[model samples]
Target: MRLSVIAKVLALPVVFFVCFFLVPLSVVLMSSLWVQNQLSFEHYLTILLDQYHWSVIWVTIKLGIYSTLICALLGYPLAWFMIRIVSTPLWRRLLVILLIVPLFTSNIVRSFGWMVLLGRTGFINETLQNMGLIERPIRFLGTELGILIGLVYILLPFMVISVGASISRIDRSLEYASRDLGAGHWETFRYISLPLTLPGLAAGSIMVFALSVSAYVTPALLSGGRVTVLPMLIYQQYSTVFNFSYGGALSIVLLLATLFLVAFANRLGSTKGGDK
Candidate 1:
């Protein structure tokens, strides 16, 4: 293709990105750097150097990493079952609908549902208490576990869909040949199937991690004001304190961190895929 043709092809998306993303980000960046109508780095220093902020960042990263790992561990088998085991088209369609139905509902509604389930008098606690699993109602509403459970539920569909698509694209011939050569199912999966699905796994994991890190509604509703994540902090600055500069700083930091982690994951996935 001619250079001009290629440029024309890219022009619309480039313009769209600049207008919608770049412009707003530029404004935030400038706002973050300006203090009392003068250029400064104090906001960045305040966020980065404070112990409370560090704890919040740590909590955010922990939530993201844990959620991603849990999703992958659970999603892989589910995806395999969907792609390779369940051969009935009708059942597969039903399963796919079940996976996606949660997405149609608002995040608030979903989080509220979890809150009901995890509350002191919630069904889960009552059942467990009645069954003698615990003497008292365990606290889940204001804890890390509560947040994680909600995140995993919300993010599992993404992982399953991504990995299922990848698994569907793999060559069945290779697996059959491996089996013919007397390789066990586990060996075939280890050497052929798993490697082939790494790209999808990586994509899904990154998506889940990014969303978990930035998640506000689920954590806010489930946390009951006890747990704090970066997004919540940013929200507080913008909503309660009316501090755009600090909020902008937090937003830029989050954006940069997400970009860096995603880029690293993409590079790692590409390298592993190439090796396989």
Candidate 2:
């Protein structure tokens, strides 16, 4: 009776996952493998043999790597500023609210905001011109730079929050100990603070990287079709081509690539920590 009651309590989430997550995934897997009632890898083979497909996949991965690295470089300082530098709770709360407000808004709205800011006649170009930085409005829209900017903006808050939480949880005594050891600020940060924050950094990197890889709207809206990516290709196959098999194969490829990178990063992190 105890076991039965326990299983019944756990049943709700299991059933929910099965009905929602597993069921839809199973449907897609079946469609991808099934053709004329026989299982096949033909759809996957089609994608594997295509150069255009490989190029898009590479672009997506490259964009993700660049975005994540930039977010970390920028976010670390911002996290440090929020945690160590900010003394007042009100300002910190306000800054956190500002960060979250952008996240709460839809991607379409954020991409649209970038669309306005990155245009040839946009605010960025106008400011550069006024400062005599350029004779002409540099082309940002429908370019890789524009897409990257949008991706970074959309993904940065994740890094900040992750690192911030980690920073907040850090024992202040650790810093005091390092300082009392006659360590310089850079030495303290390099040796003591940074190593402790690695977990949060890794978590943030994975989150940003995965999201950047699968992002469609930012790339689609910013690229203006000049650039192509795996997610956009998947969208095209599903929406315009209506080829569920090919779309499923593409989706699987993206999923696998993301999983592989995340696993590698996690393993690398663990190894580094263990060695330390």
Candidate 3:
């Protein structure tokens, strides 16, 4: 009776999941292949055969990786500070509010902010000019550097929130245990705390990487059509060119790539726990 109940309980969710998630995804997969009187690899083959498309894919991946790295480097310390160093709850809440303000804002607005700051008459250029740091205002908008900055700004909160949760959840006794054993702060962090936080870091990294790779708005606005990304290509195919099969193939490519990365990160995170 108990086994029957358990199976029935599981079956309901499985049905719901299939209806909601799997079915829609299946539609896309099927559509990606519906070309020229049969299912075929022509769509995917077209994606791979183009050198320029490959270059765009490479650029997108590189930008995602770079932005994720920057987020980790900056977010770790900020997370640590917010969770550990800030003893007052009110102050911590205020800091968290400030961190989230940017996240709550739309990507268009955020990228526009960057557009202003990076433009010729903007604060960054004006400061440089006043200090005689550069004879001419450097170009940031409509460039890879501009896109990178916008991406980093947009995705940084994912890193901070995930890492902060991990930092907050860490048992303080672990640090005390290390200190009791005559370990200094650096050694304690290196050997004990950091290892425990690996899962959180991995989680944050995956979020940043996936979002950065698939991001459209920030790149579209900041790149100013000068720099092309995978999302931009997909958007163009679906929106402008009206080539659904091509867009579907691109969507599948991004989805599979993201799934591969999540699997790889999960494996690494599991191994990280074993190391402790």
Better of 2 and 3 by TM-score: 2
Report lDDT (Cα) of residue 15, candidate 2: 99
> 67, model 1: CA deviation in Å?
0.5
- Candidate 3 lDDT tens digits, 94-147: 999999988778888888999999998999999999999999999999899999
- lDDT string for model 1 (41-92, tens) is 9999998899998899889989999999999999999999988899999999
**Each model's TM-score?**
0.95, 0.95, 0.92
Write the candidate numbers in order of decreasing lDDT. Answer: 1, 2, 3
The better-scoring model by lDDT among 2 and 3 is: 2
Clashing pairs in 3: none
Please state the error at residue 263 of candidate 3 in Å: 2.8
lDDT of 2: 0.93
Q: Compared to the true structure, candidate 2 yields what TM-score?
A: 0.95
Candidate 2 per-residue lDDT over residues 55-128, each given as its tens digit = 99999999999999999999989998998899999999999999899988999999999899999999999999
Off by over 4 Å in 1: 1-3, 266-276
